[model samples]
Target chain A: MPDTPFIDDGSNVPLSELRWPDDDLTRIPDWIYTSDEVFQRERERIFFGESWCFVALEAEIPEPGSFKRSYVGDVPVIVTRDEDGDIHVFENRCAHRGAEFCRALRGKAENFTCPYHQWMYDLKGKLMAVPFRRGDHGEGGMPKDFKLEDHNPKSLNVTTRHGVVFASFSESVESLEEYLGPENLEQFDVVFKGRKLKILGFYKNRLQGNWKLYHENLKDPYHATLLHVYLATFRLMVAGQKSAMICDESGRHSTMASAKDDNIEIGEETASQMKSAFREGMELNDPDFLNYVQEFDSPWTVTMQIIWPNLVVQRELNTLGIRHIVPRGPHALDMYWTMFGYEDDTPELERQRMKQGNLMGPSGYLGVDDNEAIKYLQDGFKHSHSQEGIVKLEPEKEGSTETLISEASVRALYRHYRQVMDI
Target chain B: MASTHPAGTNLSPEEARALRFEIEEFNTEYARILDEQDIDFWPDFFTADGFYRVTAKENHDEGLPVGLVWCDGRPMMQDRAAAVKTTMVHAPRYLRHYNSNVRVTGVDTDGTIHSESNYLVIETLMEQESRIFQAGLYIDQFVREDGVLRLKARDCIYDSLLIPNDMVYPV
Candidate 1:
């Protein structure tokens, strides 16, 4: 928890600090959120390791020579589409002195030139040229054998599916499809659906909690009803709603789906108990704003999908979007949320998406709760730092379940996380 | 975008001075209620049929329709207030809103005032030092409803691309 500079070499830190509970994924150590060794090891073992991380959307750089800057863990990356119409991702760091070559969020450029010393790279991240390669005024220059090809920035193995792009630092990592697993991919295909995407805009928020908590926040459905009164207030999500947690075989990828049941039936026992927590006299004068237009064939009104390490494809009743996690260090992370709708959406649909969007961003009806809960976690994890936090809501299983009230999904996420992290 | 004088330049010096006084007074009262965390009175500052949005300057410049906080009418604004009270779970913090560089850009045909002001909110959370929560431009349109200035449209375009943690309340 002390001030520690980001060091890639975890060997320097004590092994005692990076220790996890004796139990497999049942108990997560608080130190994982604050340990410098774990944070550094994760960069290499999980992020730069064999795990395929979601870097960017292929739709973001649809045009030839279009590029968008992203990050794989803390390491900056550039996702670009070359003139040949191939999508590629490479380290944003310049080969020369490691300066970030691309500064803009997105732009069209045939070449990415590092401003530090004008070291240029092609769209595929192949180092093209270096200024003064052959000495300027016949004085001094590069050695006759100084090859431009030798200085190419590190590039990731890239793949695109359903308009989303996944990149892996390790060429040996499983293909995007294999890594995402068939079950989770099915839910992903639901949001993407081969339709052209229209990017509404981005809402980036810097959080005080570790990035993993945000991932856990999405995967954990038990907190939804308790934390977000808006969901229950509007009957969007209830205590015992018709829902299912469809987790992938690997327990890495998952989708927590909750269907909105119009045919009301809450037993009196549950009703009286929940009524105490539900906000009374609360009414939406414009109920049309929260109304779901039934865009997807699936009866789910709320779906939070986690494609591990970063990508969170969320479908919160017409507000379809992706929340990309950017982990800064042990205690902080920045969330880059791209709120969008399908290209073929009508004006009415667009309005619906915009109106519903207020339910998810940092200021949304539901989002505000998460922002607070995670910070409270960080605060707890920091000061009174517990050795292990409980996640036994649905103890019988850890991957998938039918109950909306369970921590099984989050427990599954950690189960997969530990496999990769080896904490 | 900064507002340019549309009709204020044509006003008599006396009339302009009086308008400036009235507008400044309204902004002061608005800031006080917000800083005090008076959510109930927040919507009262606007007309029944008003538009309020919190967005980034990048989106504003591009004319993007999306906003961080978008409320079409007083009902929605009231909902926002009610949500903060009932459902919203955010760290309690003290927000001090400072509005300055107030300018009445123009006067509409029916006496609607188009104005712009720069605002900075300093947030002090429990046991944490006060920090710059948000700094932005308030692009506004005000109309006299019953001889009192009520905000018709308030577009708070924050220049910072990233908001800290989460925005519990409006800017």
Candidate 2:
């Protein structure tokens, strides 16, 4: 017999090779979702170990002294704009010990001072100050020379393009744009719009679910039509539109997009039933669904741009925003949603964008449902089951695809996840 | 003063009474429309150039600034409603808006009335099982036109810092 992999039990592969199920080859073991051990391994192997993650947008820290506290994987990081306006990302923990240096979410700061001791460092991660260096007595004093340069927080490599900022722990990782791939890059530019932006606002919510669930939510386009019925009922998106769930080459990034179509009329009964079921009133003013209709040089009415690891850019009709998922633990996540409009947006157009903004966020009809659904998904995984959950809704194709509905992109996400995690 | 009408909204005692009645009726109708998931009726609550904002207290005060949802003009609001009803999908649920402490604020030179009110909304879903989905407050500002009260701007300030789940409907 050929030398085969053996089980932990002393039993040889000949006895039981763990017969793989052909019918459900795409399914992942349910233990991954519910096991603490798996989550811990994932943190070490994927998050802390390697992989490029989106930490912040270049637009967030435009000024030279501006800085925004963000996270990569589970590690806290500080992305700052130096005097030259170059962006830099550094671990938020102090080098002396593991104390968090920056507590504020965002602000302009010249130097980062450690709260524990008076150790200070400039924005460039260069040590600037150290208190009580020339001590009083010989016993209390340090040796002939003490260098502050030896104690600066470690930093990850950062890259910014078209106003988006990305970082990576792995030196061998490809260029940020290359890692993003074309499909995701196109979706990203849809809202980043290749211009300066004015930060409209930020919304943060503590969700009681796994962070991966949120990523899966964006990759799975089938849920959009059903999860955000408010979008359909209001005639913003229709089944007749040419929509698609696209993924990057590495299957790490995804874009769920669709065009606006008003020609597809619904039956009176169905329309009325839909309208009645969601009661948010379909008729606000007139049926000017095409109100903010400046043609975007793109294919879809909206793009839920899923950047691998953390960021989700929602390029909705006229409004654009980024939803950053910061995981606190296996069962908790903090969703930081930042809404934005261009600096050149006319007051009227800005008003319209703000109005449409109501359709998302924590209170928005569509967003609330997504929050609730993901929670339920995690809740379901609490129980053990013989059958694993399936994201294999469309296994017939690979890469970019067509169809108003399909969870193929989500399956692609899992494929990449398994690859990265070496599962 | 906490009356049936909002404060600073220039409504005479008698006018306040009538306006209060109309406002109460409007709130009830609005809730019914949402409870029934009537997306078509959603836009009708605002004026042609009205504003609708659902923002968090943290964002509003700290200037962290982001709206849960925002609609500047009625057209955008209408589009949202149409989209949600026609294209969006989620588990069905019933939304109940319980509005109280309505006080009329200052009335603008134009018939626009600045009003503020404290309201509580609770949502329950029917999945063959009943579940409390969300509960929050509606902080609103309105205007009266030709004996009709129209919501000029309604900002939903949810007391709970963390949302229970996804809020599928506007407050």
Candidate 3:
């Protein structure tokens, strides 16, 4: 590893200069993680392209006139419910001057009034009023042909599945159900299942790494058994557990799932392989922390769904959350977490969910490992002259796998990524 | 909900001042333990049934039930301490905790004290400049265990909406 001083400006490497190291997905070029040109291209071809990005949960803005500030990739947007109880997603930029008008994270309002010029827009993002349309005292009035509707702010194609909200810049994008194929949809529904969601709260943290690394982290289960000693030591998701890394037809989305088996002992060979991660005699003083209430109908106790480009639906035991990945340039990304429970949950169940929440988040037992690892990875890519990352765990496998020791799902993600990015 | 403290037991000015002094002293020691990164001893500052949580003021003001670190009991805190010490992987760093403005609000009939204080935690990583990691207010409920003040509950409500990377250590 050469400790070369790498300049991050887009000028260092042209987009045309970048190419795959090999014709296969086993070798991932480091430029994809550290190049500014690649990040800009991702914003265009992936985030603001044809993909549907998860913006907000319907539960966040449940009532009419409720609104929450959100993002599609790096572009700020507002997710709102209008007077008609219809959900809408539109740019937070004011139609008149492009100032980010909505500042509060979440609130209820009849309409939004831009503080810059008092240009008012209805909840549906239609320009309803212009303070100087006729000009104050008729001095600087707009042209006679200016129409209020013509000046409306940009809006995205909005769709909802169960309680999750997704938005796309492309008007002709596929439906949300079709976007998440049948296999992925089945696993998605296992957690959603039409039950009203109760918002527990939120956790926001910025990880100093490429946004794609977050998706890859969830898709790569090999690291789960090796990097996170807490998870492996407790057998929440050890290597020998019943698990599957199931990918969608397009290879863009996947679900890394595992069923917790308390009585099933780890085989000797597997235990030896995971010796560094598993502690011989460690135990939680409160054994109830790892208790599985068995609330869902699915067999897997943990199903971490990497839904294409921006969403991660986490069903880790009883703790349920949606992680929205907001890319910030190439070196940093903001992770917004929305933790929830069903509306009809008993007080005890809600508390249990909160207790279980300790396993994930910026400060969680397992989550801290991933965040730190991502930071270290970004540091490695930024400072080192190394140009390739190896993903050849199971050389012959590509899509789904029954073994946790494979990087098949990671390879599958890049297979779709290369096509979508046209690299 | 009615007040858990009994009415008409308002403390004298001298008693309130003395209680505030005790709380200030207790917080100074608490901050020292965390600043030194002696996480294994972190659980001992709390009562057996102690509750600890670290949440953003946005969520705390909205009465949200979630926490970045929600531990319902001292056992859970012990688990977190043990894991942070033995299992979790993070960059080497130093943290300095500044706790001030201790105010004792009330004392229940059982001598449990309600208090609030402002805190600032500055972190310095290897080869990096020190920065304010978290600035928060700690809302606490304290009780005497064998004549020493121990926390019954400590709600660390952070004012920073976006954590820098991750809170590797508890504040």
Candidate 4:
């Protein structure tokens, strides 16, 4: 691809070349919060330019002929598995007109037929047929040189790791392994775990906040304790404790982790309720509350995997899930949360997983609060008050363990986001 | 004219009007409890083991089997109250609930009664520039027991799906 004027050096110069202060940290300007111009630039530069977004898990379209319509940063994409079990992703728009061809959320289809004009496309995005194209005599007919093969939906470069599929609009994007980096791949392993997953269900939430707020919410270690106290009550996560706000070199991938605090002594009332609820309460109701069962090889009680712009692989207890933040508008974002478990999970374990799942999803103990806060954050941005916001909690080291109440991870996100959006 | 009244069932036309007024008052009081953040008193609007669910209409319509917030029993509700009051850190704001169109649908045996009403809630946050956070309707189901009407279920059907911020309180 030829270089665009702004990206001549193969680097996002708008942000990186700025004569910023020599200090290691800086507060992000608030205009990015409620600015329409910033969003449009982001759409062109980052979302449509050079990023391999995780579109769908291979488990979603398990059998051959299964297809699902999704998006990569507001651009419509159709992901399908052909009879040969090969997964392919292509633009969802029809060749004749720019109408969305795949209307259904998901289904098993050999070929897709456009509703507007009777144009047909195969699962591999090949233009199969057009109605009335072979007419014997007609005043209005196809041009003699019209070629169907030339109008096939353009396919994107794809890569898969542990049944997780990713696609890139740019051919220059590094391999999926390198793009995700070693630290990120390790986090992916925590949820994917090299096992066939069972998609329990999907939960969608429309939040009136900037897409950046959702990213910062997950990365910020400051809010978990105060915003979601239900976790604290159950000794799941406690604020003001030893924790890590981790970020990679590029500041894209991040993890907000905390050690299981053993100091939470279970109350008699809570213990009694747990004992009565479970017939065989092995470690379900640990009196000490610090019983980290070592479900994964990691040390964190919960780690919110900030996968670049959209994906967040949340390992919350036994009920593992992924949250994809689809940007709807400058003030709105849709959270598509997919909850999953291993194929061999037992009934009792499944029940526990569902109950624990309540701690995260839309109705979850934490998720709703996050949603409410996001709304307020947007409402605040609509004012003429402040221009710059601070994220200087851990100025010394970008990825160091600290007291749970720190926003270092959020700072890392803004730093990387500024680079990607080039504002 | 030979007029006969049913035994132990005596009420004048004006008395019926007074009963309607009392029911409306009871409903408004429940809303007051929530508006004031008096969550401890809010549970009094339900029975000990009554179910509570605050869900989006989309999920409810599709039988999507999920809610923004779901409390199977009052114990869970109480637990949420305990958590939010102490541990949930969020921006301080006010929720104003306005209820009207109260209708007494039917009378139940044992003096219990079923009723329905409509409501609107306006939320305002106290930032430097006070802003209108959200506005939505509240679909409520009520039951009268022991000479008092209590809320059975309160489904907050927000017309706007995009919430302004993190919802820190029970609607």
Top candidate, metric lDDT: 3
Task: Compute the lDDT of residue A101 as modeled in candidate 3.
Answer: 97
Q: Sorted on TM-score, highest at the top, how do the candidates line up? A: 3, 1, 2, 4
Alpha-carbon error at A272 in model 4, in Å? 31
Give the Å shift of residue B31 in candidate 3.
1.0
TM-score of chain B of 1: 0.93
- What lDDT does candidate 4 reach at residue A234? 55
* Candidate 3: fraction of native contacts reproduced: 0.88
In order, what fnat does every candidate score? 0.70, 0.63, 0.88, 0.28
Q: Say which docking band candidate 1 falls in.
A: medium
Q: Encode model 1's per-residue lDDT on A1-423: one tens digit a residue.
A: 332234332223454555667766668778778777778878888888888788877777879999998999888999999888999899999988999879988879989889888998999999988888889889788889988888889989988787888888898988887888888878888888768888887778999889889878877877777787787777778888788889888787788899887554556665576764566456786777778888786867888998778888989989988888888887889988888888899998998888888888888989888998998888777766255787878788878898877888888778777777765
Error of 4 at B139 (Å): 14
- TM-score for each of the candidates: 0.93, 0.76, 0.96, 0.73
Error of 3 at A204 (Å): 0.2
**Model 1 steric clash pairs:** A135-A141
Positional deviation of B26 in candidate 3, in angstroms? 0.9
Best by DockQ: 3
- Output the lDDT of residue A146, model 1: 87
Tens-place lDDT per residue, model 4, A97-211, is: 8888898767799899989987999999999998777565765667878889988887877888888888878889888777777777777887786678877656666787788
Comparing 2 with 3 on DockQ, the higher-scoring candidate is 3
Which is superior by DockQ, 1 or 3?
3
